[model samples]
Target: MSERKKQHFINSVMSYITLSLATIIGITLISIFISFWVTELADKDAQAINLSGSMRMQTYYIGLVLERENVEAAQQAIEKLQNTWNSPLFAQQHALLQEPKQQHNLLTRHFGIAYTNWLHHTKPILMAMAKGQHKRSEIEFLLENQVLLTDALVTQFQNDAERKIVNLRTFQLLVLLITVSVGSLVFYLLKNRIERPLSQLTETAEKIGAGDFSQRVDVGGTDELTLLANTFNRMSESIANSYSKLEERVDERTRALKQHNIVLDFLFQTARNILESPNGQFDFQTTVENLSKVLGDHKLELCLFTERGEKPYLQLVSHNKAFAHCEQTNCSECRNQDSSMQALLLSRKTGFPITIGERHFGIIDLQLNNEQELPEWQHALVQSVANQFAIALSMSEQKDKENRFVMLSERTVIARELHDSLAQALSYLQIQVTRLQKSHDKQKYELQQPIIDELREGLSSAYRQLRELLTTFRLKMDEGGLQAALENTVAQLRERSNISIQLDYKLKNVPLAASEEIHLLQIVREAGQNAIHHSKGRNVLIELIQTSDNKVQLAVEDDGIGIPQTPEKFNHYGLAIMNERSRNLGGAIEVQPRSGGGTRISFTFMPSITRQPIA
Candidate 1:
């Protein structure tokens, strides 16, 4: 899921959780409050109604004093009290008061047994209380039952009320304890299972945002909160894991891209050189050879394919002696055709094309000895190289056209100079010779000989200058072959300077395009020049190493004056140019101070001798 969606879901879940918890708490509070209110009401109702039995007894006492037929009336009042006591109102009152005092002496003895029986036998008491109605013993009996029973019942009621108050207080205490326990439990549960974990999750998220993906949260329960915690922990873990992986991948990709850029830059510079040269011709064979030497054992097979209608064909081109040839194949999947050529043709989708505007020049294709699919990034690098090739080719073509015009202009100037100076001088000399012949004199002959000698000398100088120019041109063309170019450069360097030079070179046998070869030569020449001009020591070491990316590297190191100590001093034009050249070739130049007091200029290029797709 998208991060936004995931965040929204998490937020929604938290909102719901908050609402649910709020509802549960609200319900619990309301329930407790209702219970408290109901208890209070029941307590008040019990106190109010408990006076009924006492009031009825008082009335019966009055009836007895009047000596009327009040026994039945007292009995009726007693019956009314009993019925009232049997209902929920009296039951509520009794439950609140009776149970807790069951084991007590006053309540159990007087209230529970004696007082209740006297109330039931009130008819006899009232009758005895009537005037002239019974013997003294009976009257005494009546008064005993009436006074003692009423006194005991009243005392029982007071004691029961006090005990009920004590029980009610104890009940309130228990309720308070239960409420506290439940609240504490909820807080503890929330803390361990939800709160703490959520806090950790927030911390983890912050850490992740800060580019640290190493935080984790603990899971403590199987409730919804626990499930949420587990999910959050997993999400954090995933983020950390993915972030870590992403960093590593980015780092790896950056390095690879840098390397690829180096190769591309090299190719670009090489192509540019080939294009900008006075002559438009370039040597691909040498370039391929140098690339192979630099790349090592993963063989490079260079092919030139001309756009044959809508398709491309493999035209084998190589410089190394170990290289094989491809013939008459259209596709790699064509079993009946040359497998290598067929493979080359079939692998066009993997190959990057060189194009300029509406023009399609060609393609540079490389296949690694490995079977793994090229990573997308590497494929992109390949395409970038192809694009550079197209630009380079276009620039070279334009440069070639411009060079032609320049050449024509130079040729015209030279011809005019020869005509206006040398030709006229020769013509004048011829005329002078004719005059001397006619005169037939010794002085004239001597003058004619001097004139002829001067003319010959001038002509010879012109010829020599032209030959030198041709020689220079040949050298430039030969420089496209990496090995030839390196040899030629070393030879020239050795002849020009007193520095001793060593070259170690190895590469695949494939032929590279002319543009590729020329850049390699420039790289070699730059290294040699830097060594000669900057390094104050004698010996200079140059090595060409190839890597898996179908690229070649030229490293020059010398036991001489190292790179400047300060950053400003390090910004010398030569070093800057060298670095730029390396970058243009899609490579890097590291000018490190040698451990033993020299400068090492190492250039690393990608798509190295063995080209592989990025993974």
Candidate 2:
């Protein structure tokens, strides 16, 4: 049966059971109530009968006395008793009570016959006695008949009461048996239907809580509780499937991260080499040329274009023979040129300014070789790279400025030292020489001149030391700034890997403060290396952009293998680095698997260490 239909059936069945039980119970209670009422009525009727019989006996005793006033009172009491016996009250009382059967049929018949005879024979005699006109023998015979009738009626009343008591006791025992049987049945039904299932549900819950997803609920029938158990089972299965897939993804990401680490080491070595190279001169043309060669062989054209206002100019173009030449001036030339161009144009128009610490930089563009064939992951990579480049460029420039400032501050300190020591000593020595010359005592002049010469030599030495300090300070401040570090990193990535790469020649706001820019550069280098080695992606995109909230956004996207899906693998070193860098800059990292197949990592850093103000 369908789940919902089964649920309805269960509900209907439970309802029927409940209603049936309630009806039975109601009837039982009502029957007991009726029995008690009848018993009470029987007790009252028996008392009334006994009292009436006593009154009749008393009237007969009065007749035996033959006193005038006493006989009248006795007759009045007998009349009252007869009236009560024939009343509706007595009839109603008798109807509620069960009349007992006579033990001896013959004796009962005889009693009735004798009662009738006595009533006929004694009435005339009683009238004579009341009028003082009865013969003595007739009065005696009437009295004897009255006594016989009274004895028979009294015997019948006693037997009737005794029989009713026995019947009541038998009825009470029957009711007690019915009640106990019903109660036991109800208890059994409750335990089977409710308590047992509830216990099973509790056990299942405990198992799931203890991380045993393998446990399945054993449910029968279509009851609500059974349906609840089914839902629990489905949920457990779904969770297990999801975690299994997640674990697989985690394993994949781990493998990719290991490869990325290797690439980073290679990039590191390349960067060190470039930094140690002569006169800050590196082979940029060779790097781009090699990238172009590789893409050319792959039949995938790699073109670097500069977007100026509404116009785009191609800086470097590499295409296979199948590729067509298009005008770089009009964006429409690439309107149908490639999907990457579309994405690039979209990012350019909508992209916010990129900032790193106090520095803000310009936008970036990405165009693909295949215009018609754009994969979802590829699109994601484009967006991720553009954003990463925007942020990295801004931060890279800022780092340059800070490094310069630090170097300048260091030189300034040395300058202050020179003024405090060498210059002051020179002034003191000059004053001592002037005094010695003015006094002109030959021996004093000789001694003071030697001391003055020694002081002069010390002053010359101090001046030389100051000159050296200033020179060293100037050299350190002037050479190898934050921009130099970033350039070295980019050059190394291109040289070490076969991936095609290009940095916009005129990334606006080229200079940045020291710390923020360097961190941004590091973010870019790390992400780039990861993409190149781990993602196994052919192309890399690094972007530096700014957002509306006066913050810098850095994104790095690659067509590389995507991030791990498992929670355990989700906390990998690459992710950790990305997260740490973002946190250190008071930002957050968003890592999403590319729509088609890849990973996109992006982070946003506000200019100041405070939350963005509400709009």
Candidate 3:
């Protein structure tokens, strides 16, 4: 036999509930209909009993009227009795009691005999009494019998109503028993089929949550719970497989991470060794030695070309010299060597170029042993080391170029200084000497003395200016930088003269280049000296501030006799020097009368750091 398929748990529960409800409803409706029918029958039976008693009273009335010879009254009473006997209520009751299957029952047979006796014998006797014929004995006997029969029928109807009520009560008790049985069956289905499976599922889920991936649900049935159990078992199996492999995966990741850390440390140590030297220099030999330690038995060589030559001019080798292929007297000869020999040498070695951008400086070569090849990671490490060498070489070369540029600029400054100060002083002295000679030759005694006095004054002025130029040349900025240099210049000037000189330096955050600082210091000194000698000022203020447009402004203001419109008339060579220095600094110098009765020498220029480079 084929196995019967089990219904879904929900569908089974619904069907049971629906059937129980329908049965209860059917029983309730039947009970209500029977109650109504029994009530109506009882009412009819009551009416029948009331009529029988009334007929019996009518029978007594007929007998009384017949004895008095009152034929009309007796006839009226006989007609009423006949109408009541043949009424629809009595007829229906008669038909109901005459059941074919229960004809032998005592109550049914008694009712039938009483109805037949009244219709045949008792009714005919009443009709004769209504016609005034006194058949005394027959009338009396039959009327009494009719009264007895009606009494007996009334008792039977009362008994029948009582029996119907008992049957209704019995059917209600049976329905209540059926309801209780259905309810118990429903509870059994819930506990065994639905609740038990849910409890097992909850326990399995708790175990899974506690990290026991091997736990699974085992519910069985062709229902939703069965499908859920199968899916849960598969999920647990998959999780168990993954958990078993987790340690291997973690170990693999750990090894890869350790290797990465080692590579990072190696790169860091290599960079530190290459940049360890002072003054922007690199210690390539120390870096190469470190690389040899890491490479172990492998032979490593660094071959470098000259700045303007194709031949290798320098070679640095590791401790192991097992693979020294270059044995030529001159490295240039290797370039012209036999091609087959060169190919053979190249095949035995691996090389990474040491270059940055388009500039090639050198190459690093490594020779492997027989039947050995470099791993990818080791090949990448060698390439990275070569790149580090290129970066270090590039930085060193840039520092050298910057040093040469600074030297050339300083030389230019020195030449400009000599021309502006000493050369001009010598020319003036020579012109004075020529004037003295002409006066002496003309024999002009008065002109000769004044000319000699003028010559002595010119020589004294030249010597003083020469000493100032030497002081300017020897100026060096200390750690305090431009601010400190200005402060020192102000103090020296204050000591030399009884002038109140104040320095208002506002450029605390500005970064000045070496050339910018030198030119600025020289301009300030020249301007301050001019103020002391020619302006005859009581107070001088030197202000160094930055302007709103990012230009640096230096102002030397003095409350003195101010500057003349034509400063050259007073032989102000210092003004020319200040102007020259300003031009060299790429700025403009303005010597104008101050608004407050003094001279203000303002030099405005862009700071070197803020200036854009010329393309």
Candidate 4:
């Protein structure tokens, strides 16, 4: 609304209300002033009535004195009443008392009659009393009549006052009724005109606040209330408009948030799958197939760069099951560089780098075949997915390298043991053959029985050593810890041999490293194997105990022909393998004769580690 219109509306409302109040107050005040004036006029008339009665009494008494034949008292009384009546208080001769009437006329005429009659009645009594020959009966009669007239006048005045009082009370009641009626009318008008409109505005505003933007107040009249309603309606429209836009944006954000959540779930699942792979190997084929399902129209490829014949080779494996070209690890057939990869990444295809530290192993190539424009967020999501898998890939690569290193080191150790024990024993068999040949030639075909038994013993020992070596290589500790592996080995040994085997174990729940536990269990196995195969013992005892000094002591005892006491005679492949494993375990071994005519082989290592750090 314009300022002019608003100002005019305010002025109109204020002026109407102000005029109503002013008219009501003016009428009430005028009526009240008139009532007060009428009451004062009645009071003055009552005073006039009283003064007239006093004058008549004075006349009556004056006449009484005259009747008593005291002319002087009569004169004095008459003069005193005249003096009082004509005093300055009543000196306004022009002034006349207005006679009281039963009915209200604003102001009556012939006002001087009351004063003139009152004075004239008093003059008759005074003159009659003044005569010297005046009869007592006449004076008394006159005085009694004057008293009666005076009583009648006083009664009239009292009656007039009562009537006036009644009239005033009636007028006051009328005035009160008018005031209440006017006030009620004004309140009703104000309530309907202003309060009702303001209430509507308040209700509409509350509705809008409660998210009901469709709410609008009905506008009527060209006043400030109407302008306010119009403004409120406009505000509601604006709110509704803004809310619609905001709702659209909110919906868009919600959809985007859900999409991001889906992408995040896929990435997390991919990471979990990679970590859960066997021996920490990456299962790319299943992973990419799941990815293809999530990103349905895209072709996925896992490209790995490796060296073949000292040259860089790029291996590319596509998502299609029939599209297999090269192994993920051994990419020997691939003959490609960055240009070939760049060509492989066609116009519709994008490549996210599969990186392990500084080197980019290869790209995770994606070919988007759909017509829809790929969102930048999806591309960024693909890059993030690639980033996550790159870490898993890096870990898998490191784990495989560790496994190969472990296998190579084990092979070298086995080779060293075979050369140390079996190689030397076989060479000694070559010497035995030479000695037998020399005896046959020198003793002239008289072969020594001791030499033949020695030869047969040597062959049996060599055969046993070969079988033990094979068994050593075949032995593998399972997921069940050292105790379980030990029990399993003992059970197998008992089944393989006729000797009675016994096991006494105390090392339960020992916190040993994987390598430490594996070597320790294998050491026990090799010990048991040797006792049964080489010793010809009937019974064997294997005990794994934690010593008082916090060292793990594994002992294998046999009731059999004991090992040669000399080091040279005891040097065999099984013993050699056991010594090498003990050195690797950071422990010590002792081979000695048992107390009860048996062989006792014991290896002891610290409960945790053999030694603390050098520092």
Candidate 5:
């Protein structure tokens, strides 16, 4: 197709408006020129008529003067009449009337006859009368003829002026009619070509802007508006096509996002179930059931290998059924030889290994139907779930190991305490018994009493130490932690004595490990016991506080007879035990006499939480 010529709408409208203005201006200018010409001619005609009337009056004046025999006045009137008749204003009017082809015209002829009578007959006759050589009848005849001709000329001048005015009026009316016709034509053209098309284009554009892309302008013309309409239609089509494609893409993205959200929700819920399980335990059966639901039609099973890694000892199925291969006897042969288990092995299935680095725990097996397959994303999801299960299992196993280790460690500590306190006391009693036996054989009854009393004291001491050990072993940190334990110990000791004991505990915000707290509590109890037994003071103060260096400081003070400078080690087993406990806490103990009267026991140690590990 031949390309459509480009036509700007602005230029076209300007051309029409400019043409209309030019036509109106031309008509107005012509009318102005004609009106000016007609007005000027009318003024000249009026002047001519005035001059003619003066000439007629002068003719009559000359007649009167002649009748009275006044030659001077008659001569003067004749001169004035000639002057009026020959004035340039009348001459011009006369010249205008003397058209060669219009010689028979009434106004022209009348003017000529009137002028001829004035120049030839009237003037000479009047001159004759002025010289007093004239007849009354003859002068009257000439004057009468002159008056009649002048009146005829005057009448023609009036008629000519009136005719011109009528013609001007008619011409002005025609010009007005032409102007109205042209203006109406221009207005019609502008409304049809420019205004209507533009309105259509504007309305169509608004519709398109309002999202109705199907709207199109059908302006029929070769102007710029028509071209705009075509271009607008094409643009709308393009936008519609693009919008459709965009909607399709949005739908596709929405579906994919929904799938991703489902996957993420499944993973989040599974992790939450694992974390919120009772006693930090992971529910594998619940996890497998959730996994089966997420996998749609796939059958899921979790098989765990034995401790020795020889074979699978436990299996959890998502269908909530007993292990199909198990006979409840935990026999390896039964599990390995079951036909159902063999069929599952040989069938179409996918496996995700439950593993962490080199340690393989088991396999998460998905039994797929015939000809079934998994997408890459689904495969990755299943693998991630298996990894989560492996992590839970690994954490559970690690926690068990730590508990066993802690148990063994506590047992070792108990054994050591037994050997140090109770065993030693018993050995001392055995020696005392041997001494008593020797005295009896030697017939030394007096020696027997001292030995017997010594044995009894030894046994009592042994019994006391044993009870203390038992109390230490039985000590467990309750909800109130070490502070509550300390309070209970002080309360028990208070019941046994009248000594007022005050516990000044100030380490409220300090973080302490369980082992550290246990040792600290034992040391405090042992020190309190020693204070009650040996200090014999009226008041005992036990203070526990944190120092500026972030170390814990424990002080036990009394106002009683102070410890001897050379105290026997065998008598101060409590001091030895306190020293041992402080050493275990990685701290130091000080035994010093109070400045007034009693002794003070001070123990300072770095809190386990604040202590850094050795390189």
Candidate 6:
């Protein structure tokens, strides 16, 4: 049987109970046999005592007749006594308990000896009396020891029988206790293994029936009841989830209805901020602040393109407490782009350009900080807000040109209209692919392991990046340059490993391009992973220092076993990725053994442009 069905249900429990009851009954029969045997043994001892007493009495009567010189009567009495025990008719009724009947009994032999001695003493007196030559004074000595030996034997046997009865009683008491203990233990096991879980299950069911889906039974053991409990818990979770989703839908619709009425405030707010400015021009501070309120909790970056030969003006606004010190600072590092990376390492990054009919003007970048993905509804709402911005921007830029405004309005109409025709047909192909992947070990039969692995890696990375998109809503990014990025990397590693991952910053807030920061971050992450996976490193120290040659040095040292003599011994994908990132940074990576028996991996990047910080 499968493991699930082998468990004992109610029927099996009853079967075990019945078996226990049968065992008790069998034990009871054995106990009864023992008691009966004890009783028979006591009776046998009593019978032996009685036989000895009777033989003594018969001997005394035989002696009295001999004393009266009545030899014939005496002879007849002795013969009757002998026939009662030793004759063929009485032999069937006579036996020792643990001996064979062919063996002469000591009691019978001693009794006959007493009889013969009496005859020796009495015959002399009887013959003398017949011949008128009797002497009576000497005859008393032989009678003195008469019946004494048989009386002592009877006392000894009676004492032995009493001791046997005591032992039997003790044995019976022990048997009774054993039987009671066994019964109690069996019932105890049945109650714990079956009754308690059943009771909990009953309670949980009642709670669920009362619409309390949060309640659950704590399932234990490897039995049918455990399986039942597991099923019950799953049912409860499903009900809870259904109710939760229903409530969430109700709340979402209510909020959408409320927000729908005030959604147009975003345009008025932006225009109001611009008009309120002293110079009557767009202001980043007011624009970003008002825009952030409508978009809720996400980092907002607004940039307006200036004329050629001038840098674009950038402004950032967010409600995150961690970014309080970074206000008004440049966040150019946040815009790093690595097109080759399948995963958006920065997560949910969406950018909308402020343009009117191909006339690019400004830009808006919205993102989250943590790993929580924004729901599809929220994404649509944010996109709707961005559309309003686009319209406002276009209207502001073309206040005098009605023809251009009409052209700008047609762009939105064209984009939304395409969704009805070609877009819907492409959706069908996506559905077919989804179906194909849902069969035969997720379509692994048609794909090799490496292909499957690559597919999985791409999908996993994309899903993670998408999910974490909204959580990046938190503005945890530092405007303090590479130093802040390294600190963030160290903090991430420390959270995952028990090993101490400390950062030693020797360089000031060195100015690195956005691309340089991303490359450095990837290299640091890859190096830390290599230390953990390859060398089983414990202590990892990250250091960033300016080299004597004016280049920046980033090193990760570990107190682990040194690397192999040949670096190419293993297919080190992480190492390869790290090297690629280093090359992209215009740097050289060094791998060498540490002096104290570990590995120190370092890389140096020279500044590509002749740029220096202001003194």
Residue range 1-615, candidate 6, lDDT tens digits: 654355555435556677778878888888899889888767667776677567668757766876787867866766666654453422423444235535645544454445444446444444454344655454455334656754655665566678888989898898898789779967976898689988999998898899899998896766666778888899899999999999999999888877765555665665565455443344556556665666566676555553231234544444533232123443333222223211232244355545556555444566655746755545555555445555555555555375566457445433432332223334544554454566555656664544456556555644543332222222133776767877776776677668878888886645666667767776777687667656676798888888777788889999988889887453244566567679877777889999897889999888654355666
Q: After the best TM-score superposition of candidate 4, give how far the Cα of residue 86 lies from its true spot, in angstroms.
A: 8.1
- List the candidate numbers ranked by lDDT, top first: 5, 3, 4, 6, 1, 2
Off by over 4 Å in 1: 1-145, 214-615
- What lDDT does the true structure give each of the candidates? 0.59, 0.56, 0.75, 0.72, 0.79, 0.62
Model number with the top TM-score: 3
- Tens digits of lDDT, candidate 2, 446-476: 5676766767786775675455335333332
Off by over 4 Å in 4: 5-134, 144-156, 159-167, 170-174, 198-212, 280-286, 289-293, 300-302, 308-349, 370-373, 408-615
- In candidate 2 the C-alpha lDDT for residue 123 amounts to 55
User: Candidate 6: which stretches are off by over 4 Å?
Assistant: 1-19, 87-146, 238-615
The positional error of residue 541 in candidate 1, measured at the CA in angstroms, is 78
Residue-level lDDT of model 1, residues 459-573, one tens digit each, is 6745643543343335565434667677777898898689999988876554555555655666666567767766788999888876555567667889997877763354243
**Model 4 worst lDDT window (10 residues):** 104-113
Q: What's the TM-score of each model vs. the native? A: 0.32, 0.42, 0.72, 0.61, 0.66, 0.33
Q: What C-alpha lDDT does candidate 2 achieve relative to the native structure?
A: 0.56
Evaluated with lDDT, which candidate comes out highest?
5
Say which prediction, candidate 5 or candidate 6, comes out ahead on TM-score: 5
When sorted by TM-score, best at the front, the candidate numbers are 3, 5, 4, 2, 6, 1
Each candidate's number of clashing pairs is 41, 27, 0, 0, 0, 11
Error of 4 at 280 (Å): 5.1
